[model samples]
Target chain A: MNDDDRTAMKKRVQRLVYMAAGGRISEADLGRYDTDLRQIGLDSLGYLNLLEGLERTFGVAIDLDHEEDHSFLHTIDNIVRYLVAQGGEAV
Target chain B: MNGDPTRGPIQDALTDCLGRHRGRRAVVGSEALSYDELGGRIHAAAGWLRGVWLEGGAGGRAPRHVGFCLGNRPEYVILYFAVLYAGDLPLLLDANFNTGEIESIRSDCGLDALVIEPAKAARLEAPGKGDQVPFADDVVLLPLSRPGAPPFEPRPATQVCRFTSGTTGRPKCLEFSGHAVVSAARNWVLGTGMTGEDRTLCLAALSNGLAFNTSLLSSFLAGGELHFLKGAPLTRPVARRIAESGITRLVAFPTLYRNFVAPGGPDRSAMAGLKHAISAGAPLWPDVREEFRARYGLDISDYYGIAETGPCTFEREADHHSGLGRPLPGAEIRIAPGPEDPDGPEETGEVLVRTASMASGYLNHPGLFEQRLDADGFYHSGDRGRLVDGRLHLVGRTQDHINVAGRKIDPTEIVAVVSALDGVADAVAFPDEDLNREALVHLVVVAASPELTRAAVAAACRSRLASYKVPGRISFVAEIPRTGIGKPRIAVLREQLNASAGA
Candidate 1:
């Protein structure tokens, strides 16, 4: 993916995170891209919901093999980088 | 008398099931594993476990309490049998629990070893050396060592253990005997009229009671095809599953039903194969129940149970009576005067239950379980219900446990954790209905300083409690309303919380 596509994809991911946190988290919160999602309001379940949203938005199978596998996929920056590496592109 | 149905070790049942029921489907979801295949896998895993435990190493002693940090996979079932087959207690841990919750549980039960997924184990950073072993194609096992944890011996006859909310502090692990575990599954199958032809679609995680007793072993023992849903339980996905697998029995919690009969409900013909659907844990709204019946031509039967005591009541379609239904066989339910009565309580008594499937006691705290039980053998279920003309109707619970999205959140437990924070001067928690009419945990606290904002409280709770247990809404209150006995007035406290939210 090009730099513009990657930036768009990251924006979409942050949008999904905002949706999952019920608007308690906003774009301003994503200024610190490495902010722990758990501390804000996107909890473990919220993270799962965010994954489901990403899978739908990106048309990619970002789901883990098992629910426990999501243990390593928590902060916003980690997930964005992982998605980009996994070939997810923004339309 | 070999399949006597009520008495036997679950481990022995798997042994008896080996290779005998070949060609009969055991699991039918991600991949079809017949009894022959499942039985072989169980034996193989057990053999590997025994080899590892018996091998020479520091602290060669075996672990009595072992935790299963597994997910909703077929290998989870295999490891469960393998753990029990080796005469060890398998503690089912939800993969969704956080690092802090996991550490608290390890300390509570004095767990010697935990078989967790590699990713989760890494996240836990659990003490002791970690070794990776193959569990299934995609899942690997990480055996966690609690090197310096105290050694614990379970109560006599303890067979299976799972954690439930405690009155204070971390959650307590409840232990069940071999006979109790087997009887729970057996009675469910018998009482529900499950047959080999029945293809059940399990919708909940295996760690929960609804899925464990009502769907998992119960389906296997009855020679039924156990199917796991591939996708979410929303209307479209669930309808597709029903059409594809011809799921005869649907065992899911109530929210799924609410979603099914909501505005954009599933097509009527798609649910044609569903013979009977059951909901456990919290009541099903009458409108949802009626709409499901109207649209699908089936009643959403409700099952009432307590985590401490298993399978207290099953709603049978008898006499057109519709309250929590009748108690299951081998269950003794007592209704006595509540120690502290609820305002406008429908039932004038509290429910006490004793069943063959009841847990032996809490593994960590001895005599803690008995404190809930009176002079009689019955455990005082925190619920308030009434029995009239042989039907039990539940009004409410005296405890402040909140049920949000199928998880039990203890208000007292949160209060203890939040109050211990430096800037917090007393904290109170209660459940309130969100805009969607779902339960949400709300916290009202007297902060030592105004600088302790909502974000600050959220950060503290996120560090300490499980994700689900964190308060959805936090507010600052002047003081907690209390009665003459110094107990927080719940009605007034709820009003304060509601007012703060409104503001």
Candidate 2:
């Protein structure tokens, strides 16, 4: 994906995470970048729902096997990488 | 020869009452079946079963294990008693268990024959290579609508298998003799203050030990009536029946109680006949218990028992702080010192019991059974508890203790505190090891509101518990994960968490 598309995807993923989590994510922290939901005080269940929401929002099927490796899901940079590799398979 | 010495303790109690008070009421669904009529049905079922068993066998041999997967109905009551009277063992399989779970349990327990509802029977999967049964046709379809027969004398030395809840792993078979039934009946009567006048609402399945002891045997032996609900997700009609039938007591889990005690819900005010309510399967959350008690004007009795030993300790007329109440008669409890404290009975330890109704061992797993059964035959219940002020206090499961970071946190303790929080309906703490640092991840069901924040929940936990005991992270949910019986299914919650992470 191009830079503009990647930026939009990242913003959408973060929004989806907040929405699934009942908007518990602070508004001030919305635009700011975070590696993973865990760093933003989201629990495992939170991180999971974040992934689910992102998948549903982006219409992509996440590769959960690789997602288990923290390198894939720990930070926003890693997660966007994982999503790119997912190649936009619909949920 | 009337050889069934293991006959249920309540059999003679009912029979003797039947002889003097034949006009007394019993139950067949909503209908008030007189004692004589119920006795007649038991007799008839016994006679029909005897004939069927003899026909199926070469030399009058009764089937060792007959599987029953019928819903809660009058027929199940008849069949269960008939199986006991016929001196044949009946395997009570879960009606709601998935096809795979059902087949796995049936095969693992080595069911010789099974009786299932026609619809459920059709849903059975075809046998695989490892499957011993040649065909689905190998299972005999017992006529559920068959009439009662003459009560026949049972042959002796009979045993039946009831599967454990499989909370830890694949369900294990716990064997119970006729004597266990008898002992359990006597204990139920003494423990619950059951009399001939008390009418019981049979909410729990007859298969589980709690239902069998508290409802079936307790009612039969006490000369009280047994009212069984027809289907699951008990509807308004069922609730109306419970009130209309004048059910004096209901022995159920928390989930069912939540349904009955919902906001402006049932005609609970009409249920004036209800004298007491009993809860088991899992620890009754204080809110649910208080709600039930206040609505019904009855003290909620919290019972603690396992398939290994039937009806060990119960909260009979107990205050909220008594833990699980004292041990029932013919039951002895001891707190086995944990590795943390191997000396005297401190605050908490593994709760073990020696009971007249204790199972001999787990079926086919002698070593597993032996590990639980100690030198003097005390069953080593993996549950941790404390002996406090001559009363037993259950802490939590030994296996369920999650090592969050470096500190061990009992999910039960977290649950108790979290459940009491405002807008927090329920909570389950599960182990989450991320990057080799194990911590507890809490799934919390909160009331739908913008104010229900994870930070608020964290603050509540901080105020209620120690620093190390607080959850590492919290996720808001609409409802907590639950098992078929309404207990907080911790494993299911963990699975849902994992699936969430994967997505």
Candidate 3:
């Protein structure tokens, strides 16, 4: 993915995180793409909702059982990188 | 064989059930375990537990308290039965409980040992912490040294204990007798029409009353297969499991049902094998229920059960679309008259439940459970509901606790945690919905200083409380409206917040 595409993807992933947050984390606080989502109140339930949102929106099916490393879901930047690696393009 | 002199009724019943279905699959997690294999494992685990108790110098004083702080897995099942077989009381604690709650449980009710995951056992740094013995692959038996006696004791007949959210970090432990538990399982099996062919896919935490009453012992009693998902209950994985395992029954909370009806959810074919969909913990939204039925062709049976009284009622008929179904067998529901309709039979008041599967009492708080009971043995459920054509329809709760998803969180606990965090001033927590309409704890804080940010308050709460107990929404206010007696005027506060948001 190009830099511009990655930036757009990061924005989309951040939006998904904010939506999944369900007001648990402020939208402004979610601006930092590298900040750990859990540290900003993205709990287990939030992660579940985020996973569903990611799959529905980006078509990236993250099978947690198969993925040995869960850090891909820790931050927006990581999520965008993982999504791009899985062939998910900027919509 | 009539009964074993050494074993309790629960253990005896379980042994009989397992022996009858020796060749059948009992439980499936990462792998499947046959009834015969499960029985043998339970027998061996019980023997090992007895040895542990003897080594701990509590030999003659059988029935030590063993806390289960793990998730829904086969090891949890095997060890739970083994605890009972070894003549010990098993306390099923929410696996999400933090170290503070675990310590409080240890101090309030003496825990001889805790069956917990190794990762948690590694982080648990307590004063009376003892040696950790490996039990299963990822599970361990961490013994705790009880200094002197605990503040409270369980009743002699109390065989198992489960907890409800309590104020100030101490979860109220409800003790149940062996007979009560066995009766609950048997009634659930009989009422739900479960059979040996039924494969139950339980998604709720086994510590929760919904899964505990419906799936745990009842599956074995009916000689059925109990299945547990390895990871989170995501829609795709759950649907895949249902399709692959031929799961006949799905016991989950309302949030999951809502997800099933959401856009991009799994197709109806994924849930083709499911015959019964049981939803509990909190009220299922009407729209979600209808949408789920329209999409999946399955009517979600919204189950009504209480922590004090086991499984109260279940909808038996597939076509019954009305109130929470008629009371299950061994259960009776009586609606006391409210002031509006004193002479009518259909009066709506507190739901009074008298069930053979009722809990004995609260082990921690003495007489707290009895305080709610009336002249009859019926326990006041605190829920306002009227019986309509023999079906129980709930109106609302008389209590102040907030129901987030399926877990009942005491708002006072959240308020206490936030208020203590150099939080300047007043705070009140109440139930509110998020963008997705999921239930969440809304904490409104009145900060004394301008320096206190939302991040600070949220950070304090995240560190001190359980993940579920943390408030999903935090708003700062100048002052909180209170009644003359210091009760929060939640309706007024909600109006003010809404007006400001619209401004």
Share of native interface contacts recovered by each model: 0.07, 0.00, 0.63
RMSD of each: 5.1, 16.0, 2.3
lDDT (Cα, tens digit) per residue for candidate 2, span B168-202? 22355666666776788788789768898887887
Ranking by TM-score: 3, 1, 2
lDDT, candidate 3, B279-369, per-residue tens: 9998899999999999999999977899899999988888889899999999999987667545544577889999999999998999999
Which candidate has the highest DockQ of all?
3
- Say what the interface RMSD of candidate 2 is: 14.9
> Where is model 2 more than 4 Å wrong at Cα?
A1-91, B1-21, B53-62, B105-108, B126-156, B165-170, B233-235, B318-321, B341-345, B401-503
Q: How many clashes does each candidate structure show, in the order listed?
A: 0, 19, 0
Error of 3 at B168 (Å): 1.0
Alpha-carbon deviation at A69 in model 3, angstroms: 3.4
iRMS of candidate 3, one decimal?
Answer: 1.2
Docking class of 2: incorrect
Per-model DockQ: 0.16, 0.02, 0.72
Write model 3 residue lDDT over A1-91, tens digit each, in one string.
Answer: 6788788888888888888877767788897999999899888878888988888888877888788789999999899889988987533
- Candidate 2 vs candidate 3: which has greater TM-score? 3
Sorting all predicted structures by DockQ, with the top scorer first, yields 3, 1, 2
lDDT tens digits, residue span B127-157, model 1? 6646777666646666666656554456657
Q: TM-score of model 1's chain A, to 2 decimals?
A: 0.75
